[model samples]
Target: MSVVDAWRPETAAGGFTRDDEDVAFYTRINALIHSDMVVVDLGAGRGSRYDEGSAPFRKSFFNLQGRVKQLIGVDVDPAVLEHPYLDEALVTEPGARLPLADQSVDMIISEWVLEHVEHPQEFGAEVQRVLKPGGWFCAITPNKWGYVGIANRIIPEKVKNALMRRVWPDRPDMDVFPTYYRLNTLARTRRMFGDGAWEHCSYSANGTPKYHGNRSFGFALVGLFQTFVPSLMRTNLFVFIRRTA
Candidate 1:
């Protein structure tokens, strides 16, 4: 068996095997989904989960098509137009306003997208403006204070692309983008959204050192070491907030 298959379960909670960051992220958003809600997928690309060749069981949680009234996809990349799950796909420019009317969407979900946001204030303004009153915006992103974020910020984009190609060959080069950690940290993000307009909650999560070249024994060893890292500097941040204004 591959390293992920053999070692992931050992690191998972209660050795369930299937539990991981993706499961946690999708589960949190899935619970918030309702049949009548219009959901916007911010920075949605061409249905990347499907491209990753995940099993049906794994992909099931990531799929968010018919469960909502409408699943609108907005992305700076035109590849979003090909998103299989989107009811409507609109192309947008970086730092440009979203095409939807103000308060039109009931929920917005961004996965691995915030790290690429160069203009956070403009992005936050669009998120707040597009969501209906009391709308929810949930996102999963790399924590700027974490090892991954630190390395990402320090490394050149070309080097990152090459390293990612070596470590995760399955992921396409087109999916990679330059990262700016301006909105990645807990303090900065909280400040950007502010307290009066949004009710927020955020937490950090850590998983196996998958970037360590797919070796099972090495992965297990590093995974154990990862447990001792402070919670605040964990690999990823899951943010959930409701628009209060």
Candidate 2:
């Protein structure tokens, strides 16, 4: 058995555990989805999850291609044009206005995208502009106060990029972007998406440890520690906000 299999037996048969973070994050978004709603995927890449070999079951939950009326993906990377789960794709410049019209979308979802947002005000403004009055904006990002975020902030860029390449060999170099962490913490996220214009809830969550160096012992140790870490110290933040205006 592989180290991950030995460490997480529940994921031995497939890449899912009791409280899988992907499952949890997607579940919330899926519940908000309806057949006729127009949806936008912010910072959507070229469907890298498929390239990374996500399990079929997990992929089913992540794919929103046919479930919604329109699935538009917007990202800075041109690779987004080839995104498998989007009906349409747009490549935009940083801080540029989205091509979408005001109040045109019913929902917007962002996964692993907020950390790279250097200007949260511009980001939030764009999101608010495109979404309908009752539209939902949901995202899952690494928590700025978490261990991974702290390490990322302290580590040298070259060293961190080198280490990430070694740890996630399957991930493409282009897919890795520099993180600013300006909108990562709960406080900042709340401020960006709050102010009576939106009804929002943000919380922390823990996922499987990925930096165990392929060692079963290390994986198990970190997994145990992850379970006991305080809420604010959890690795990920899930933000769900609905426009109330």
Best by lDDT: 2
TM-score computed on alpha carbons, candidate 2: 0.94
Look at candidate 1 and give me any clashing residue pairs.
none
TM-score each candidate.
Answer: 0.92, 0.94
Consecutive 10-residue window with the lowest summed lDDT within model 1: 10-19
Candidate 1 regions exceeding 4 Å error are: 9-19
- Per-residue lDDT of model 2, residues 1-245, tens digit only: 76777766898556787667778999888888999999999999888886556888788888998999999999999999988778999999998999899999999999999999988899999999999999999999899988788878999988987887766565666777888999998889778877789987768889878777677776877788788888879999999989999
Candidate 1 residue-wise lDDT, 139-229, digit = tens: 9899898878988888887798888776677666687787888899788878888959899887788754667667766677668756788
**In model 2, which range of ten residues has the least summed lDDT?**
164-173
